[model samples]
Every structure is written in C-alpha cells, then in structure tokens.
Target: MAPYSVYVRAVRLALEEKGVAYRLDPVDVFAKDGPPASLLERQPFGRIPAFEHDGFRLYEAGAIERYVDEAFPGPALQPSAPRERARVNQLTSILDSYAYRTLVWDIYVERVSVPKQGRAPDEARIQTALPKAQLCLRAINDLMDDGPYLAGAALTLADLHAAPMFAYFTLAPEAEALLAEQPAIKAWWASMSRRPAVQATAYPA
Candidate 1:
C-alpha cells in the first residue's frame, strides 16, 4: 500500500470492523505507468484496489464496497432496496465529488511542493470548503436521522467515506470550530470516531 489513501484506509477498516477476511494487495501506483501491470489487467484505470475473488473482478470504491458487503457474511454495509442503496451511493458520490476531494486538499494546498498554490489555501479556501463540508454533513445528518447509520440502523459504506476524510479535516486548525457549527455532524463524527475499528485506523502511524 502506498501508505494509505484516506478512502482506502476507511474501506480497510470497514472490512476489519465487519470481520471480513480480506487480503491487502499493494499495487505500486507511482510506477512507470499508474499501477502495477497485474493490477492494470483488472482495473483499466489501474486503481489501487481491483478486487478479485471467487473468479470475479471489481473496481471503483462503491463497487468494491458493494462486493465486500455481499461476499462477506457479516454486518451489512448497505440497506436493502433500490432507493436506499441509491441514497448510500449518492452519499458516496457527494463525499468524493463535493466534500472530501476539495476539503482534503486544504493541507496540500497550504503545505505541499506544488508549483503554485491557488487561493493560498487561506481563509478563503478554507471557508469555501467548510460550508461545502457542512453540506455533506447536512446530507449525512438527514440520512442518519432514520437511525445510527447513514443508510439506516446499520453501518454502511457512506460512513466509511465520511469518517476518514473527517480525520484529515480535523487536523486543520479550524476544523473543530467549523464542524462544531453542525450539531448533527459533530455528533455523528463523535459517534463514528468512537468505533473501535475507526479509532485504530484513523491516524497514520
């Protein structure tokens, strides 16, 4: 594993928490091309996790999450039904597209060795992402209202996406204050972080 991408780490933790037997296949994504040659065969885009088991191949985080949920006999990771499952998928999309992608970049923009940093990652960028993150929190709050889980009473892949990225966000100076503004989000973050699986994998070693 190239250390651990926040998303990858969350999925790994989800599997662990659910007690699903899984093997971590470390693909060298920084190699000459994207990932290793073997991985390329499974993932045309050469993503880090190209899941294969029982002679089936799967790619993308959502697909991988679904496969893990189905293949493993343990706590369900998604709600049953087209609509509820769609909601879960939608939450994943919002996290990947709207919240985490940009919010998680705050530190990188402020700290990394990029040629140029747009917006200075200053108050402006931070402020922009904060509301967007709150948007994610609101959706999560609504989804979670039905039960403890984002999809329902059971922990699902939606929580998997939310928890770890929140890890990155809290590392920022204003994270607590920013998240504190959203009561449901603050509570949910607290709940998810307290889970044993989440606690073990949240911080980097």
Candidate 2:
C-alpha cells in the first residue's frame, strides 16, 4: 500500500506467518488532502501502516511485527535463543536504517514510482545510491549463516523485515542487476519467496 511501502509489507508478512486475520485500511500520505484524522491519531508521523488489533493500537513496522508474533498463536517468528534474537534484531535495524532509504526512496522511487507518476527517473540519484545499496546487501550477506534462514534454520523477523524491501528492489532493473551479484542474498530471497505467507502478502510485481 501507499505505493511501495515496505514497512507496511513487513508487518503484513508477519501477520500472515502468524496466521492472524486482519483488514487493511490503506492510506495515501501524499494525497492532496493528506492523511485522515484517524490515521494521524494512531500514527502521528503520518505513515502508511498504523495497525489496530482488538482495540490495541500500534505503529512502526518493527513494533507491529513483534506484537503480531507474540500476541498471536502460530509458528514463532523470533528465535528463542538470546544470540539468535539479537542477530535478528541487528539485521532488522540494518534494513530499516541503512538499506531502506537508498533501496526504496532513492532506487525504487526513482526507477519505479517516478516513471509511474509520468516523471522521468532521476538517473543521477540512482547512480549515487547504487553503491550504498550494494554495501547494505553485502552487510546482510556477511551476517547470514549457512542455514536456510537469515538467523538460523527457521524463519525469523529478519527475513520478514528484509523481504519486502528486496521485493521492491527487484522491481527496478538497475537494482536487480546489483542484487544479481549477491549470491547469498539471491538464495535467501528465493527461499523466502516460496513461503506461503510471503506469497500471500507479496506486493504486485
């Protein structure tokens, strides 16, 4: 929703993995009229995914994902081991802080969103952001283990957090070319894409 909001997609994937049924209330923060009062009330920052579950309100994709995993009954998305949980959090942070801006705002917005809006892509911005985005991918690949998942043998919040952004990244040819060089990341994305939960929540390509 909101034209490539990976943060929202992260929360949706977590909910799907937990088998929690929820309705989506889409918001266009860029609308001429701006966000509605209800959304602003829940998310004062005027962001895309402010969730409401059984009268409990939550914002921020990471917090929403943790709540979904803990509050619902299904396979655990978080690792129980302290070290593994820490690793999951570490990857999530990297995606949010380092990768998201360059990958989504700079690359995806320039290549996909701008073109859709009938504006030409800013080639200069894409060129500048590519190396930073590549560095983010390299960092993630280095943190990854030999296991099938990002944290360990099982799916964790890290995988969910990063998948949506990767999906968006794949939408742009330039970003896709850069991703092709990351074998570990490509393998991980393949595995994550096969998950039923991921398939269900995936944004249209």
Candidate 3:
C-alpha cells in the first residue's frame, strides 16, 4: 500500500513524521508498472513516488519530500540558513545524479561490471562512476564538521538520503567493505538508520 520500493521509503518516513494523511499507491518498478493511461499523465518519467493530491499531480522524489515537509511540518527538515539549505539540496543532487545508481551496478552487475545475463555493463560507466562515488563519500565526510549531520548539526534532507539506500547497498556483503573506507558516511548512515522515526517507518518492502 506504500508507493515506496525500498528506494523511496525516506519520503514515506517524512510523511509519517509530519503526520500527513495519505494513501499509498505502490508503483511496481520492475516491469513497466503504472496506471493504464500513461505514467506521464502522473509522472513524466514513469517513476515511482508520483503523488496525486486531490487531483493535483507532482513528481520527483526530492520535490515530493520538500512538499511533504512544508505541507505538514511536524518535525521540520529544512534549516534556516540559505547556505545550509543549499548544501542540503546540493548533496541530494550529487547523490541522485552520480552515487545513487552505482551501488545498484555493484549488485546487478555481479562481477562489478557484468550482469547476471552474462552481458557486461558499460565499462566506461563503472570506471567513471566508482571514483565519483568515492568523491561523494569524501564530500559527505567534509559535511560532518558542524556535527555528523550533512547540512549542519541538525538532521536535514541530507539524512533522508541514507534511510532510503540503507537496505539496498547495505544488504550486500560488500556493503561492509564499502563502508569501511568511508568512515563518515558509515557513521552517518548507521546513526540515522537507528533513529526511532526511521526504524518505525522501515518496512523493508
């Protein structure tokens, strides 16, 4: 009943934390799952987490997250400083654009570049991205100065990024190895994954 795959649970937790009432319309991502007409009428990308609030439509996970936080506002997410807010948005973009999909590669591509189908993924994509993921991890480390939190001392949209990915990249045996090198990210992820709101909302698909 949740629109969430493990990938988008953070949005759900935000909704729950804010105490917003809504229904979950789970979108099956594996095999072209969407409403009969076209997902474009709902979400142009045919992606999950598209919301229909009283016939008003919206898309994009981050936009949905910010909307929910603003609309409900029980346990606020965004910080006051314009710079801090910029950092939150910036880190989210970096994660979404570069780092988010790579861990899936490390999984679906069992040998790190070859899928179960025996066909190889683009060697250039992996080579290009692994280093980028490393940089993202390092940037996360640098973000921890004010505290372990990403934007500042408080939990902000930065922590939302972790709740969604924990079950995915994490279940892999290699996840431990991946975390070993990235101490800051590991600490941030572990700390957040243990929080009461996150724990309560995590249903693991």
Q: What is the C-alpha RMSD of each candidate to the true structure, in Å?
A: 3.7, 1.6, 3.5
**What local lDDT score does residue 88 receive in model 1, on the 0 to 100 scale?**
86
lDDT of model 3 at position 20 = 78
**TM-score for predicted model 3 compared with the true structure:** 0.80
lDDT of 1 at 169: 72
- My TM-score estimates for the predictions, one after another, are 0.79, 0.93, 0.80
lDDT of 1 by residue, 1-205 (tens): 4435676776676687678777776777768755777877887876665667778877776667777777788887788889988888888888888776665775433433132534344656656666666676666677666566677766788888777777777666666766676666776778988888787675555
lDDT accuracy of residue 131 in candidate 1: 68
Q: The CA-based lDDT of model 2 is what?
A: 0.85
Cα deviation at 133, candidate 2, in Å, is 0.8
Candidate 2 regions exceeding 4 Å error are 1-4
Return the candidate ranking by lDDT, descending: 2, 1, 3
Clashes of 1: 0
Model 1: how far residue 135 lies from native, Å? 2.9
Residue lDDT tens for model 2, 33-119: 988887899899988789888899889999999999999999999989899999999999999899989998899889998999999
Question: Which residue pairs in candidate 2 collide?
Answer: none
